[model samples]
Target: MKLSLKVNGKKIEKEVDDNTLLVSFIRENLNLTGTHVGCDTSQCGSCVVHVNGKSVKSCAMFAVDANGSEVTTIEGLEKDGKLHPVQESFKKHHGLQCGYCTPGMVMSSIDLLKSHKNPTEEEIRKGLEGNICRCTGYQNIVASVKGAIGKV
Candidate 1:
């Protein structure tokens, strides 16, 4: 299948297999390895990316399904020389440990903050239901989200 889409503000078009997952295309074809694949079964949100401004698991979607859409991976989250607010917040709050799930956590938190500029602690926890961080215990992750609430 031939797929065409905008990725990280760049236009992308390539031929791919019908079964090629979005994560594979991003990491293999585009060479954006920041989006990790922790659990291919979609149990872990490690492969999360933004599809048309919404958070979606790259492992759960096919490359063909992303055709004509705009996709944003963790590598795309930065602008020029500055890190995205979510990334900065995570760093400042120590939201990551092993760093395997940091990309998805940032992506999902961006979406959560978009909808709720001032989300409460409970709301932040609930919004992160899809993402799992094995090392942080979620306290710092929640603080990271709270810190980035108005910045995003």
Candidate 2:
């Protein structure tokens, strides 16, 4: 079926199979590989992307589900060659080690911070329960989110 998508602030019209996961469409079709597919299952947040400003696991959703919706990937966070505050905080706080989960973590952190405003350490931990990262042990990751709250 033909679907129109607003991705990274641009409009794209494409044809996709009904079973095509959003992850595949973004990485294979749109070539936005930053949204990794760590787990095809919904457990991993590696495929997280913003659907109209709310983070959603792309792997858990189909490309057609995003039809006519606004989607933002990790590549969209950087504008004019400048990193977003979350990205910068991740770098500054060493939030990533293997770096596989950084995109999803960053995306989720942005949304969490947006909703929480001033989140406690525990709140940050619980807020990111959906996203799992094997590296960095989440200490620096939480710090990155805390640091990016007002800065972003």
Candidate 3:
């Protein structure tokens, strides 16, 4: 199958198998390994990426499904060597531990902030309910999203 995807603001055209998952395509085809595959079942947010400005589990979607759609991975957040405010906030707030879930968390947080810039604590928690971080206790992860709004 042929797929044309807009990933991280770059146009990508590739030949892929019908069974190829979006996460596999991003990590292998595009070499954007920032999006992790913690669980192929789509339960973990580790495979989260923004598709057309909305958060979706890359593992749950097919590469062909994203044809011509804009995709944003962790690598897309940085520009001109400057990290996104959410990325910086995650660092400052200690939002990660083992770091397996950081990419998805940041991606999801970016989408969340887009919808609710001034999200309350409960809203942040609710927004992140899909993404699970086994390493960090999630206190700092919540703080990171909340802290990123003003800075971004």
On lDDT, the candidate that comes out on top is 1
> Each candidate's lDDT (Cα)?
0.95, 0.93, 0.92
Please list all clashing residue pairs in model 2, or write none if there are none: none
lDDT of 1 by residue, 20-102 (tens): 99999999999999999998999889999999999999999999999999999999988988999999999999999999999
lDDT leaderboard ranking:
1, 2, 3
lDDT of 3: 0.92
Per-candidate TM-scores read 0.98, 0.98, 0.96
- Candidate 2's TM-score reads 0.98
**How many residue pairs clash in each candidate at the backbone level?**
0, 0, 0
Report the lDDT tens digits of candidate 3 across residue range 35-144.
99997888889999999999999999999999989999999999999999999999999899999999999999998998986999999999998898987789999988
Worst-scoring 10-residue span by lDDT in model 3: 143-152
Model 3 vs. true fold: TM: 0.96
Model 1 residue 64 CA deviation (Å) reads 0.2
